[model samples]
Target: MSNLYERSLNVIPPVAARATKLGVVKGEGSYLITEDGKKVLDFASGVAVCNIGHNNKAVVEAATKQIQQLIHGGHNVVYYETYVKLAEKLVELTGGDTMVYFSNSGAEANEGAIKLAKYVSKRQGIISFKGSFHGRTLGTTSITASNSAYRKNYEGLLPSVYFAEYANCFRCPYKQKKESCSMECVEQFDDIFKRIIDPYSVAAIIMEPIQGEGGYIVPPKEFMKAIREICDKYGIYLIFDEVQTGFGRTGKMFAHENFDVKPDIMTCAKAIASGFPLSAVIGKKEIMKNWPAGAHGGTFGGNPVSCAASLATIEQLENGAIENGVESGAYLKKRLFELKEKYPIIGDVRGIGLMLAMEFVGENNVPNGRAVKNIINYSVEHGLILLNCGTYKNVLRFIAPTTVSKSEIDEALGIIEEAIVKEC
Candidate 1:
């Protein structure tokens, strides 16, 4: 009998290569039960999608009920209860001054966000940060600069796009020490506008509030404030792609809340529906209103079941999972910092809430992607699942579920410690 991975090899494309080969049959809180009945600690959280944990009772029940009542009430054709309620809840969450447009994925939502900005601002140019991963769509791929491979054969993408630096204090783009650093990231945009294109031509400046795939890099609060100021000065809309940072993954309902800087347009997905395929473009009501009907429409933007699941996910986050994320995230970070003391090759440890990461580097601060790969493989073989981030692929990111317990964190850290010791 061929195993699931072996069978998958014949049918699945190589582009969909996954982190693990284990055939997961079920999920309970922070663990995944494999085909062979091995219980693996899933710290990746399906790449930070299952915020409230997989197959959560509330989410499943809500989704099940909606599935029975109404499976697909296309947003364009008509409205539904779960869909309208979820949008209402989100609007309220964003301070009741914002309106939402639904989409099926993060990339789709990003496309909507930029289009909304362009529609309202009547501009064509966009400014994005280097090392940002917006999406795989041609429009998003244009803004994404995290990996060149993503744009290999699809060059000459959306034109009028400019890239700026993001704050990665550990591997500062400007190569300046933190103590002496003066927020060059913010200043880089000034040079961008001066040397590249006029700010007035830029419709939107899209960015991941916390650079996720670009290495879990958290920009300085000052940098965020500066970006806000520039956008205000130029009348350019600020778009925060919170696809992976929203829905209480960062201890708060949204990552932007941590910085006290709200974007004119925000895109969220991933954890919004626990594990359902759903996303949204949330914009200031004034801006969203300008995006008239027939300007944008999706046949299956807001699935009823997904919206039900999202409402449940939000309820779960508010109930206790988000609080647990704060406590466990701190505990996890403290442990990683301690591990850093033992492993100098573990160059930097940084992140917010449950979205944490440790950067691996060789002597003289050279990126050590090999170490990260080895550690990940070893951990998987030893019953722990992990993932990596960063442009160099040298970052070990810990995306544990907000519902994760301290014991699970300790277990994952133990496996990681042993894997590092054995591999690195």
Candidate 2:
């Protein structure tokens, strides 16, 4: 029989291309058992979805138990224990002032979030950052500006959508340095509201707390506060797309917590259900209550098994995964900074908790996509899996499981160092 990758060539389209041709038969903790029986250390963690590690015992048991009890009860038609209980838990975790609407994926949850904003505010305009990745749906594609490829040939998208520059201080769109920064990122809204669409016409301003696909860019706390103020001033809803930054990935329950800025609405997924398909639109009760029946609905929004898995995932996060992530993240980050000092190719190291990244650069600080590609190929060939991000694909992001140990991180770093020494 042909291998999985060869077999897939005849059946799967190129649109579903993968980072590696290696197929895995099983996963345990931080390693994947490949089809050829090789153990690969998984540092990408399924793009931050397997937070508690692949096939976590608690998540597996919870999902299996729920499957034995119930499989599919249309969320729009009926109530289920796991679904309702998970919502309640989220509400409690988010301070009891928020309500949740379930969806199957991050894109679906984001679509619901914007719909809720528009419905409640009765506005048609939306504002998103230039380097933000909301989702792939046409509705979300309208608001996403991370890459032109995502929007290629799909023009005439949802109208009344505007773009703004995200607070990427490292690259500073305004060309301002950290020492003498003038906060142009915040002030740009003034120009936007005056020169572009009226603030009153905007239903929502959506952004990722940390730009994932664009680059692991973390903005300053003041920037987040200013955005909240802008939304409040214009009576527009503020939405944080936490799909890749939530559920302990940032060592906090949510990335927004670190900034101490509360958004009017938030969307979460990725690691919400361990490895299950699940997402949520979490909004303030006052705003969510205004979104009436028929405003938004999904057939498989809140799968019982997925919700059970989410609850178990949350349980694991609270039971020490997040704390462990904090410790490991600090260690990894420090080591990365050391690597940056040793290798001039490492232009910068940034991110909070385990969501860290290293941007490779050539002379004069030009993005070095080729170097990143070479390093990743070498690392994977040597038994480690990694992923690249940024519009230029020069940013190597570290999405290690929050349950990762110091030894695992050290092992991964050793592999990374060897790749860098050999390729860079």
Candidate 3:
């Protein structure tokens, strides 16, 4: 029989990019069992979607049970047990002041979020950050600025979308030093409002709490707090694209919690359902209430099985995976920093919790995409799977499962170090 990768070539399109061509057969914890009988350490975690680890028994069991009970009750028509229960749990988790609108993917959730903001606030303009990846949908494509390739063929997108700078302190977009930095990332919005689009016309200001695809860039708390204040000042909906940073990936239930700031609207997916195709637009109840019925409706927005899996995923996160991520993330960061000290090509190592990254650069601190490609190739050859980020494709991101063991982490790190030494 032909391998999955080879079989895909005959039918699958090239639009969906794969970081590795491994023919994965099974997943257990932090390891992927390949069709060729290779047990590869999975640090990518399906782009941080398998937070509680792949094929988790609890999640699988819950989904299976729900599948038998009610696979698709049709959210637009009627509510099911799992669907209502999951929403209740999320509302409780978000302090009981928020309501959720279910969708099929991160892109759909973002579309709903923007629509929610525009509907409730009755505004036309949207402010997004440069080097941010919201989603692939046309409406979201308009706001995404991580790479031009994403919006290459699809120009003349949703209008009134403006881009601003994200605070990547290591490679500050404003090029300001940490010691003397004056929160220019925050002030850039004022310039945008003054010269670009009027803040009053802006419906929402969306951002990744920890810029994911633009590289795992974590901004300072002050910057997030300032953005919160700006949104409050102008009645703009503050939207946090927590699709990548949610579900214990950031050491907290949500990345925004780390900065002690909450968004008026939040788009979540990825780990929300532990690999299930589910996403949600969580918003303040006050705003969500005003979003009249028929304003948004999807046939399979909150599938019963996906909702069941999400509830189980949440239980796993609360049980211990989140705490494990906190401890393991610190351990991983320390090791990566040590690697940075040893290798000159490793320019910057930064991230929060399990969502960490190391930017590869040349002698003069110029982005070295070639080094990243080589290192990733070497890592895959050595049984360690990894992913790359940054618009320049020079950042190596680590999306190891939250439940990863110290030994598994050590093994992946050793492979990475060996790859850097031999390849870069």
Winner by lDDT: 2
Native-vs-model 3 lDDT? Answer: 0.93
Worst ten in a row by lDDT for model 3: 1-10
lDDT of 3 by residue, 1-424 (tens): 3389888997999988788888988999998999988899999999999998999999999999988888887888886888899999999989899999998899999999999999999999999999999999999999999999999989999999999999988888778997799889988888998998888999999999999999889989999999999999999999999999999998999999999999999999999999999999999999999999889888889999999999999999999999999999999999999999999999999999999999999878999999889989999998999999999999999999999999999999998888898755
Q: Rate the local accuracy (lDDT) of all candidates.
A: 0.92, 0.94, 0.93
Prediction 2 global C-alpha lDDT: 0.94
Tens-place lDDT per residue, model 2, 31-63, is: 999999999999999989999999999999999
Candidate 1 lDDT, tens digit per residue, 1-424?
Answer: 2288888998999999888888888999999999888899999999999988878999999999888899997898888999999999999999999998889999999999988988889999998988999999999999999999999999889988888888888888889988898888778877888888988999989999999999999988888999999999999999999999998878899999999999999999999999899999999999988889899988888899999999999999999999999999999999999999998889999999999999999999899999999999989998899999888999999999999999999989999999888755
**Against the hidden true structure, what lDDT does model 1 obtain?**
0.92
TM-score of model 1 relative to the true fold? 0.99
